[model samples]
Target: MDALSQALAKSRQTISAYEDYAERYDQIVRHVPNEREQASLKRLVAIAGTAGQILEVGSGAGYDADFLEALGVKVRRTDATKRFLELQAARGKHGELLDLLTDDLGGPYDAVLALAVLIHVPRDQIEQVLAKIAGSLRPGGAFLVSMRNGDGETDGNYHTVLWRRDDFAARIESAGLVLIRDDFNEGRNREEWNTFLAVRPA
Candidate 1:
């Protein structure tokens, strides 16, 4: 396989490993609360409004899905990990296994929330992914994405592409989305996090 393909394959394997620990993963991740993240999410929900079709790009254990549903948002949850998707479905959440690099994200959604998800996309592919996300949204729809602020890519079981905030925003704008709100916070592990709220022009 070529380099990027190899990297993505490795990432998929890493995500699939979550299958073995899906329940434990959910339990552990559920309790960690971040004031900054909560505030960011509040802003996203406010901009997304109380009712609308929302697509969550990487649902993980579905915590965000459940939270959005409680706020009366109709959510379509998707995870790249099959186990996570199954766990979400077991909770009666509408979710599917999705490969972000390859899947068709069926929607003209009112909003798309991709918290901590795009970091997994390769740096070279992030813009294309954002464009696909833009295509999935209705005109004037909101997209809230959170990413770690820094530089370069990391490879392990999964891959991560850390981006500087200004560079990332430029990328968002290039994808035909208008920047609406931007916030940065000292995230966990002492990394800076950028929470961006962008909208497709009406």
Candidate 2:
């Protein structure tokens, strides 16, 4: 199949998976942030400042948003998945529906965060999405993203497109963001978890 066709198929798979999984997802994770997660969030808040406006894409159940809110950052939680938003609302958390591909980003915020979020975006859409992310940031605004690390793709319950650090960084830079942090945490599989912290130029 062609790239566009492949992407559509993947999106269908993920949309189905998340819709089915949203209720049970909190059982998998709804706890406090781990050390790594907290550190990254702390760094992001420090760069953006405590009172700065923040936007989170794919904010599943508002997990990351909880940490940022705890740090006194005002975060607008958004996810493409409706079920996730409903679950979040049930917990008295604020959220909005946002599709990275079709929806307006509507931001000139101090930071845009997508933790474990961008991996679902297909190859053809990554550049445009990243550019939108970069454009959504205020000057010198931070962009902290964590994506799966490797090459090629995976399709099953959800669609996953992994990446090499250098290659992904090139994409981020091309999107008009400057890389300031590059790190990885080993995962159970061969592909590690790659996290990049970048910022839109001031």
lDDT (10s digit) by residue, model 2, range 82-143: 99999889989989988887789998999999988899999888998999999999998999
Those runs of model 2 whose alpha carbons end farther than 4 Å from true positions after fitting are: 1-9, 188-191
Candidate-wise lDDT, in order: 0.82, 0.89
| Model 1 alpha-carbon drift over 4 Å, by segment | 2-4, 31-35
Alpha-carbon error at 178 in model 2, in Å?
0.4
Q: Root-mean-square deviation of each candidate, in angstroms?
A: 2.1, 1.7
Counting clashing residue pairs in each candidate, in order, gives 0, 0
Q: What is the alpha-carbon lDDT of model 1 when measured against the actual structure? A: 0.82
Q: How far is 172's C-alpha from truth in model 2 (Å)?
A: 0.5
Clashing pairs in 1: none
Candidate 1 residue lDDT tens string, 78-159 = 8888888887778776687787788899889989999888988877678779999999998888999999899887776557
